[model samples]
Target: MRLLATAAVITLSSIAVAPALAQTMPVAPSVLPDGTLLDVTATGKTTRVPDLATIRAGVVTQAATAAAALSDNANRMSAVLSALKQAGIQPRDIATANVSLQPQYRYEDNKPPVITGYQATNNVSIRFRNIAKSGAILDALVAQGANQIDGPNLSLDQPDAALDEARVDAVKRAQARAQLYAKAAGLSVSRILTIAEGGEIAGPPPPMPVYRMAAAKAADTQVMPGESDVTVTITVRFLLK
Candidate 1:
């Protein structure tokens, strides 16, 4: 009987002590001894010539009836697609951007608006891998039936290399700034706590001249893809000794 009683007391005591041990456990320190944290943000930029261009071309047609307007737009749009294919543009590179039909309105002085005619519009966005021939392709589109042309938004197909270069520059700048600040404070950089990339910023493409197809034989449009800047920002944290 005495042995059984002692065993029960021992088990109860162990259970009580387990909770106490857990409550008194040590946690890792979030900061070092007398540590000073430094945060610096630096931007790096590099320029590269764009290799790809995205062109938006479409046809706008007007007729007295909705069916007539839609039929006319379809026919014109078909010609534009055919021209793009003839220029070595694959089907995967072309996509329909927008298609809409709306009623035109004319307002008279102090009178209700009148429905003038129906207008139909169809637009497609084309990706040109060979930017050298893009200008000629645009000219061909105009010769076909494309009346409205928007842009050849120039860009790089693979920007990873350029972005990596920018990142390296950013880190170098950050380290330089951190070292300067640390020296002014009579401290040395102990270790890097963390490095976080903010993001990459791509500069806008150069403006394109808008074109209206008035004649079948329009001069070949000249496309100049200027240099574009790729920028990167990095935030670094360092622990000072």
Candidate 2:
């Protein structure tokens, strides 16, 4: 009787440990003896017109003292802002980007660096909803005392529509690639098993600085609205039969 009881306890312990062992096991994919997986690449691109313009303009002033320099910059920037408003730019479209004041230094042989004067700078960022007026607005700003002008970055205001089109193009491209691979391998494509997306190429260009204002060069600036390009790419995995 004692032997029978020990055997029963041993049986129950083995059953409990079996569950733990099964939980610790790793899963492996099942495949046919001669089957193999293949990786393929596809590329797609689409372009659309850009609808917005972004530019940076501001004033730089020099004076005998820091306070004087700052005051001068403030006065000039005020005029520039007023001019932009008169040119039909909404108040919300103009933003102050940077305000800096630094002391000017003079270096001479056998002499320690000395404070010569002070320079102040004020920069404003402007976003033009209408690309047509980009050049005119820049010209007006220059006339109002904006000595530094930075890029008129042309870009799409709403990119969702363009992205949707690009996605469709990417799928078509992937399908073509899968077909080619299937034909080459003597296999037929059954269906797409997985699809992965990559970054879009339709972003705005890097900021451009116009440097000297256009008004300083021409009485009326002429702006050309260059075309913008947008692109997209996708990766697709297809199951073969």
Candidate 3:
């Protein structure tokens, strides 16, 4: 009984000391100083020639019945896929963007709408690594029964390097502005307190001119991949002394 009473007293003492130990531990400071802080946002932009192209090509077929329309669309799409493969586009680079079969309605004056026929559409998005040959590939797709073609959205395959360059520029600009502000206030920039990225990394710009191809034969298309601009924005907080 005496030994049990001693053990119980020791456990109680340890429990009482735990909170004091925690209180004695040091905590890292969240803010740099209790001084004035300046927050600045800066954007940096860089232009680069696009090395990649994304093409959207598809086939649309109309028939009296949904099955016939779908069948015609499938056959045309198959030919388009074959042409893509022949143009050196890998299977992984091609993806189905959309597929739909809808009934065509004919509206008459003061009369109820009537279903005339069904139209089927199948769209595929293709990523072309070789930008130079993209035009030729598009021409081939048209030859292979691709009635609808949109875009050759030009972009960079690896945008990280460009974005990193923009980030460096942004930081430099922010620091310059901070120094200017501190000097104007008769103070010096002590140190950077924190940095946060803001705004979206700009995406590939819109295609320059939109083109619509009919069922008629088209000559070799000429595609001009112009330069694209990449922009980055950052917010920086600095302590003034």
lDDT values, one for every candidate: 0.73, 0.65, 0.73
Cα error, residue 206 of model 3, in Å, equals: 3.0
- In the range 1-241, model 2's lDDT, one tens digit per residue, is 0000000000100000001111111222364223333334444455655567778899999999999999989999999999998888997888888999999999999999999999999998898988767777887888889999887766666766766676687788778777777787687777765566654533444434333344546555544545544555555656666
Which portions of model 2 miss their true places by more than 4 Å? 1-36, 202-219
Over the stretch 147-239, how does candidate 3's per-residue lDDT look in tens digits?
A: 998887776778778777777987888888888877877878889867676543545444553344657654557677666666666767777
Give each model's clash number. Answer: 0, 2, 0
> What does candidate 1's lDDT look like per residue over 109-198, in tens digits?
999999999999999999888887888898888889899888877777887787778779878888887788779778887776677776
Candidate 1 Cα errors over 4 Å, as ranges: 1-33, 209-218
Q: What is the full ranking by lDDT, best candidate first? A: 1, 3, 2
What TM-score would every model get versus the actual structure?
Answer: 0.79, 0.76, 0.79
Question: Model 2: how far is 56 from its true place, Å?
Answer: 0.4
How far is 123's C-alpha from truth in model 3 (Å)? Answer: 0.3
